[model samples]
Target chain A: MNVKDKYYQEVLRFWKDLTPNQRELVDHSIIKKHFNKGEAMRSSSDQCSGLFLIESGQVRAYIISENGKEITLYRLFDRDVCIFSASCIMKNISFDIFIETEKETTAYLIPTSIFDKLSKESMAVQVFANELMASRFSDVMWIMEQTLFMTLDKRLAIFLLEQSNIEESDTIKITHEKIANHLGSAREVITRMLKYFQEEGIISLSRGTIHIVNRKRLEQLTLY
Target chain B: MNVKDKYYQEVLRFWKDLTPNQRELVDHSIIKKHFNKGEAMRSSSDQCSGLFLIESGQVRAYIISENGKEITLYRLFDRDVCIFSASCIMKNISFDIFIETEKETTAYLIPTSIFDKLSKESMAVQVFANELMASRFSDVMWIMEQTLFMTLDKRLAIFLLEQSNIEESDTIKITHEKIANHLGSAREVITRMLKYFQEEGIISLSRGTIHIVNRKRLEQLTLY
Candidate 1:
């Protein structure tokens, strides 16, 4: 099925068991809008409504470090949604993360107040909330384990294997600086590693681009 | 209110709210039990019926690494409950961590089937699930941040402070080896840092015990 159709099916199924009045209430509470490339759905200190769902295009969620470095933790692609984090919206609390559109995007933003009302009143909404929380928690745990147990080279290899030719038509087009920031390593170290990989014929890097020429060889190198 | 009274009140309010006869259905599904000091209530690969609420005494949860080292992640004390974790009850999945009592303890364990049934249909049960997810996520984030950013010395300082008797006494009896495992560092590093702190008059260590001589100094070191 197409992405839009899949999303529509999901929302419909989520609200399928709910009464018609409750579903209508949620639909009315949702606000749909378009965000341009480089636009922010929400950033640090922006009081937002409830969590948002990414309907189309790509968005990045990142935090800026004390040294003025941006750390992109996760990318929110189509069909994914952000829920539970009230730091950006309510209480006027400061959040370190920025939610920026990587391309022109369309999203649905739900008001948290009404969301809570729905959750407090509806078992269907409560189940949806619990499932979303579990996913978010598992995502954080995965990131934590990656940072702790995985070496930089293994991390790079995993990222390459996961992203290569699988997403975005086999072309990542990511910059060295962004890769360094994501891996929490020095750009020089990445450059040196890439040079080694090139000599080993595992990968080729040229002009802000990296191409995986040999997947099996690359995976073997990551073992070290 | 007394702890026992508080427990019944909270549980009754939440569970009974689902239906007039909800407590009757749930009460028959719960099993109460006691565990002795230094005893494991749950272990890796041990599946149980449901969640355990620590009604009395203390329990520590830890994960054994591939190197046969146990990493301490959390200490559950009075009034806290373990729920929604596969480690607590899920079958066919190895427990991510083990739960053992530090002292003779009483806990109320609920049956998973009943809890699962109610959770899918009951708003109160879903709220409980949501809270558990949030709490676990916070814990994973704390441990992750420590592993990613904090140095061994700083982590050791925090550990000492946490274990120290700050209310009346200023001593910590937990061994340095235990602290090392919790901080994910070597015993030699902990030993050296303790010696340094002792020389600085911030602490004094003697034969399996550490006593804080300067509270302000120790706090300063931690801040550093």
Candidate 2:
């Protein structure tokens, strides 16, 4: 398959059970696009632009506070679908959430009008869409539980471990400030925690880097 | 219409655009039941029971920590549909959440088997279900924002304002413990905040009740 067909196939996997007519509607509705790292895909002021399906690379969905603090709600990876970006189509969600490309990303955008059309015609498409929404909801609920019940240190440890696994390396290239933003905390708090972790020989920090020296100990800390 | 049909009508409003055949499936599938106050509707150990459509009364969805601390995710009032309770039907959500009836609740329960069949055949059913899921996700995301960005005082103020409106009275008949449970804060923290609100003349406290004395001040506090 050519590049365009590849992207089309990526989205089709989610709706494999869709009828031929339903699939035709989806194929006609999607608009494929590319976004470079650090580019904003959707912002607070934008209406429901469309649903985004990440074919490759990464997208970070986050919200900023009125005082300018940022908290990452969740991240979308390859083959992930984001419906919140199409907020205009959803009546209940009105918060100022911004979607930014975390990596050079190629994605498929389905306009709200087409999405509504597909939703009105296909049960498979609707089931798939509802599952996507539920998964995201579960993510947000997990975040709330972590923020409300889990301590910052445990959360930081867990985040680092997850990042390391994602990169498949003990060395993680991330700054304390970025980590702070992701965890919805102050840079100073993250720095303090990192310093404590280093002092305990769990990690070693350098300019814009965190190296896990003792993965076993770090994993233990995350358990609490 | 008989009482049974009346209950079916309550759920049909959500799927008003559904085809006649789809409506027939829904009418045949729904099992209406009543739950007393403080009854557990679904627990972590239970499998996805079914989608719950609240015809009347209230349901509280919450999670309990390993340490036994409880934080409510959100509440469902009359005419609300809770899909999370039917988690088995949705493959993506695996979190352990409990649903409890906060008031004497009369509801319609649609089994996952019938729900899947209906969703597979009707676009309108699918759209309505997706909307319900999206609405709940928005509610949880809002909770995350409130927990992470807003201060205890502001949240408490907003909660009080909302509670007053829900009860349709200036005086809210609720205990500090219940309020803490709703906001996912310590009872002591809630007590301290209520005392502070009283000192500030925003509210007056009595046994099992709180009277909003200065609605303007409370509203102003929530804006922060």
Candidate 3:
């Protein structure tokens, strides 16, 4: 399906009770756009005036600390919007995110003005917001649960498994620096873990890639 | 103001945009109640059918792992809600949370049926959901930041500072066990650090209370 068809479905599922005219309005306002790997759709200090629904590839939303440390708030894949920043938009704060494409990525952005109109006039829009919030809460709770219940090694293994699930390759394409940023760890620590896991035959590493060798064992003990 | 009044004001801001009739509906439906320390609002496998918004005191929501470890997800103090169990309310899953009053706590419960209605019909309720999600995201971001940017001792220190903030006291009315649970660390480690901080004249301990002796220095450092 084309990108518009994807958002067409998202808007349908999002506002299930939307009147035909409202749904059509949403679809009409949404515009599909693409960005390359090195390009940004939204900068850290940009205005948050649109709803982004990803259709293809991936996007990374991260912040840099005052001391130049990077902290990744989200890694948006297909279907996950840059929704968390909507509060900043509502509060009139500068967007605290860097939404950069990890690859050639397509998304649909519906303007905030349109959303404001619908939210004021439409119950379906309210329900849509509720579902979006529910999903976001679920994502945050999972992160909290992982931090509380899983060890660093387990977290690494889970991340690797997730990467494998996303790509159809035993060898996933991502850098240690990127993984370090996402896990909020030093690159040195990630390299050490890669060596350790490789020695244990749990994984194999090549230049800029990691191949999962023991998926079952990785999942079994990764989050135990 | 009384605790109920404090909570009513908090909810008032969240429901500010609702029509008076809609606001009154929530007013009539929500019931404020109080619980003593150690009282359980819902235990493991119990039916969860409402959302509890904390007005006074503290609430600890934890789940028991397969290895019999109590994993604390989120701690709810005044102005917060135990939103981690919301899906259980929505999907009617037997509750995974064991929510207990950490002090003589007062809270209000909005029935799930009412919540579903408000979610569908009210912008005020939608804002509440968004704010809750934003707060949860902030919580996870804090944990992730601690995991990467701070040492174990630093994390414990920040936790203590946060606890002190919540209690609005120079002396923290909590034990090392509580600190360990909240920090996801060992009690032995917390004890060792507490002793060291005391020896360094950074803090003083008596019975179960931890007094901040070097508030200025503690603020400069990551430790509480």
Candidate 4:
């Protein structure tokens, strides 16, 4: 299939109730592009321009504080559509959120004007957009709950387990600084926690990587 | 004006784009009711049944933790619409968010079935729904950022300033425990912070209220 046909199929699969007009608009307006790992797609100062649909690879959506500390709001993977990342489309959302590629990524970008038009013309598009927005809101809410109620140790443990699962391996290749940035904590704090975990025989930490030695203990740590 | 006309004016003001059919559906399906202070509107196990449009007074939307701790997600005031509080209309959203009255509140409830039908039939309804969802998502995102990146002292100061503005009084008639609950922190933590603020002469604490003494200092605290 051609690029347009490829994106058309993806959009159709994702939102099955799209009317013919919406499908036509989406098929014509989408622009496909590729970004290398670590490339920034959206930044704090830029206006939100459109919806991004990831066909392959991963994207990290995050926010940075005035002091330059960063927190991961959520990650968009294959088949995920991110509308909030581009804030210009919706006037009520004004906060600056940055979206960057986690790896070499290929994605289809649908301009906000076209998406807004489709949303205004198609109920299916509107429903799909609402669901997506609600889903992101729920993710942020979960993060807030974790930050408020759960201790750093529990969060770190859960993060490690989630990373392991996402990577599909017990040995995860990540650094302390990267983990701290993702968790919105200082590097020293994460290093100290990892050291404590190491002393407890829960995980074996090496330079730039961590191996889960006692999965049971690590899992137990996340339970509470 | 009659009760139906009273609700009609409110709905028209909130969703100005509603088509005649959509308006008719809303008018026919809406149920106007009054809720006393501290009454629950939606609970953890209940499915969302419809859209709630606040006419007067205030409503608090929050989540309760497994251990009985509570966190205020957002608040609904006069002219505000809350769709996420009722989860049944949207299938992907499953989080347990409880909506309760902070004061005696009068609201117009449109059943989910009617709202869904209107949404499917009217592009105007769809756009309005999308905007509302996007707005709520933005609120949740702000909360996540505050919880993850902001220090408790900064958060408390910001919260107090916001409350002062909301209530239009420097001497706010709210207890430390209530403030703690709103910020999703322990009462002891808030008390300690409030005592420190008192020592710093930024605020004065009494039996059941906190009086802002130096608003400038409290505002400065939130800058960092």
Q: DockQ: which candidate is best?
A: 4
Best TM-score among the predictions, by candidate number: 4
lDDT digits (tens) for residues B1-224 of candidate 2: 77766656665554556677776777787788899999888985765768888889989988887777787778999878887777776667857888999889998888888877776666666676676776777777788788778899999999999899988999999999898888888899999999999999999999999999999999999885
Interface C-alpha root-mean-square deviation, candidates in order:
5.4, 1.7, 5.1, 1.7
lDDT of 2: 0.82
- Which residue pairs collide, candidate 3? B157-B223, B157-B224
Highest lDDT, which number?
2
Q: Which 10-residue span in candidate 2 chain B carries the lowest summed lDDT?
A: B7-16
Off by over 4 Å in 3: A1-7, A10-28, A47-49, A62-74, A90-98, A214-224, B1-32, B53-55, B61-98, B121-123, B152-154, B165-168, B222-224
Question: Which is the winner by lDDT between candidate 1 and candidate 3?
Answer: 3
User: Order of candidates by lDDT, top first?
Assistant: 2, 4, 3, 1
lDDT string, candidate 1, A153-187, tens digits: 78888777766744644355667776777666668
Clash count, predicted structure 4: 3
Q: What is the TM-score of chain A alone in each candidate?
A: 0.82, 0.91, 0.83, 0.91
Provide the TM-score for each candidate, comma-separated: 0.85, 0.90, 0.81, 0.91
Which CAPRI quality tier does the interface of model 4 achieve? Answer: medium
* Native contact fraction (fnat) of model 4: 0.68
Cα error, candidate 2, residue A208 (Å): 1.5
Q: Candidates' DockQ values?
A: 0.31, 0.64, 0.29, 0.65
Question: Which pairs of residues clash in candidate 1, taking residues 3 or more apart in a chain or in different chains?
Answer: A50-A112, A165-A170
